[model samples]
Structures are given as structure tokens and as C-alpha cells.
Target: MVKLTLIRGLPGSGKSTLANTIDAVHLEADMYFVNQQGEYCYQPDKIAQAHQWCQQQTEQQLALGHDVVVANTFVQQWEMQAYRDLANKYQAELEIVCCNGQYSNVHGVSALTIANMRAKWQD
Candidate 1:
């Protein structure tokens, strides 16, 4: 059965690491920042576009009847609604996984930013 899994957590959590172990088309909005040289160059201005691109990629994979795993810091309930809608649209089994492991964030997100996200975390 095709499944759409959402892995959510703060930066430095194990979302990406866990996504890698899952047998699916794993995607993350942060991947939008990866350059052709395989370097992560985060642009705060392009965050919205990154998410849109992630959603598009996920939809494409789902349309092909493939399982998908999306890892992102979905702090708010609304941040995950789009994926939920996509799962319904494709009739795929949906799963939500939250990561809480404390590891160094690869993107160098500031402590303040992480604190802010924690404050707004819905669950």
C-alpha cells in the first residue's frame, strides 16, 4: 500500500535522519536549498517556494503510486494540512511522526529560532 509519512520536528531533531531510513521517496523543503554542488545554502526569502516545491514533488510521487516521506519542521497544525489533503486526494495511508532527538542542526538554525518554533509547536 502507498503511504505518505510526515516527519515533523525542530531543526537538529532526527527528522531527516529517520526519513532516510524509510523506504520511500523522502523529501524535505530544506532540500530546495541544496545547490548543484551538493551544498546547503539556505535562503530565508525562498522558504515559501521551498515548501511549494516539496509539496509538488510529493504529489508527483504519489501520483505515480509511490510511497513518500516528508521531513520538515512542521511547528503548527496548519503547516501539515496540505500533506493531509494530498494523502486524502491520493487515498494513501497517512502517518505523522515527530522527532525529538537533540542533535546539532546541520543548517545552523539559531537557538532563538528553535526556541520560537518550540513555543509555537502544536503537539
Candidate 2:
């Protein structure tokens, strides 16, 4: 039973941490923050590209009949609609995981930014 899991919350809410532990093909837009040198260099300008890449990878994995997990700060309902559509298209179960605990995010996002994200987040 392939599942499309979406881990949602603020930057420091452990979305990525939980995604990493999943056996499914975990995909996160932030993974694109790593440069070719394997260093974390977040390109704010490339944010859209990162998400596109993540979604593409997820589609590929789903085509292969694999479960897929997308970890991102899906702070609003609209942010998650695409994944929901994809799951429906593939006839896969959609699972939404909400990470609420605040901690230091792996991407080193500022606490202020995390707080803003939390404020923007909606169930």
C-alpha cells in the first residue's frame, strides 16, 4: 500500500527529522539547499525550483509504486493541495503528519523566522 505522506509544520518543527526516519522515498525541498560541494547553501532564489524538483522526484517514485514522503513547511492548506492531487491521481493513501514541537531546524533558520512560520501555520 503506497502512501503519500506529507510532514507539515514550521521550520523547527521536526518535519525533516521525521521524514528522514521514514522508509518511504522521503523528499524535501530543503534537500536542494546542498550545493555540489555537499555544503548547505540555501538559495532563496531557487526555492521554487527546489519544490518543483521535490514534486518531480515524488512523482517518479510514485510511478515506481513506492511510498513517498514530502517534508516541508506546508503552513497553509493550499500549500498541500498539489500533493493531495498527486496522491489522488496515483490512487495512493494520503497521510498528513503535523510536527508541532519547536526546536533547532537543520537548515539553521532563525528562531524569528520559525516563529513567523508557526504563526502562519494552519491545520
Candidate 3:
């Protein structure tokens, strides 16, 4: 049996950090922001593609009988629902963690933007 962990938080939140501590196959779309020079580069037009890649990776890892962890800014329940479906499809145990700690610079996300995201976070 496999397990899937969905770690959600704002841009500066420690979602990725927490995912690392869990000893799972961590996946984060922000990784897509990285450029060939190993620098972070945010591309507005590629957000959907980044997410699609993450989803595909999750499925592949699950099919290989490995546990997975997804770290993303899932401020709304709907944003994380697809992972739930994937977990069910693979009969994998699913877990969700909401990281609320205030962090900055780790992803080059500004404090103001993180605050704005917090304000819009769904309950």
C-alpha cells in the first residue's frame, strides 16, 4: 500500500519544508519555477503546465508503489481535491497538512504577497 500527503500553504509558508521531513517522494510545482541556471523564475503562463506535471508525477510514483507528497499553495479545498481522487484510484492512504508558519525568501515570495494569500485562504 502507498500513501499520499498533500501539504498546503501560502507562497512563503513552509509547505515544502514540512514535506521534506516526512520522508516521502515530495513534489512541488514551484520546482517548475526553476530555470536552467538553477535560479527561480516565475512564469505566469506555465502555472497550469507545472501543475499538470506534478499530477502526472504523482500518478507515476503511486503506480510504482511509492508514497508521495505534494506541497502547494492549495488555499482552497477544490485545489487539492484532485489529489484525493488520485489517491483513491491507487488505493493509497491520503493525508493533508496545512502549514501556517510565516516564512519568506525560501521561494522568493514576498511578505505582502504571502499576506494577501493568507487573506484569501479558504477555511
lDDT of 3 by residue, 13-116 (tens): 78878888998898988888888999988898999999988999999999999999999999888988889999999999998888888766476767787778
Worst 10 residues of 1 by lDDT: 1-10
lDDT of 2 at 4: 96
Model 1 spans > 4 angstroms off: none
Residue 86: error of model 3 in Å?
0.3
Q: What is the lDDT of residue 105 in candidate 2?
A: 74
Cα RMSDs, all models:
0.5, 1.2, 1.4
- Winning candidate number (TM-score): 1
Q: Which stretches of candidate 2 lie over 4 Å from their true place?
A: none
TM-score ranking, high to low? 1, 2, 3
Tell me how far the alpha carbon of residue 112 in candidate 1 is from the true structure, in angstroms, after superposition: 0.6
lDDT tens digits, residue span 27-104, model 1: 999999999999999999999999999999999999999999999999999999999999999999999999999999
Q: Report the candidate with higher lDDT, 1 versus 3.
A: 1
With a 3 Å backbone cut-off (N, CA, C), the pairs that clash in candidate 1 are none
* Top of the candidates by lDDT: 1
lDDT of each: 0.97, 0.88, 0.88
RMSD of 3: 1.4
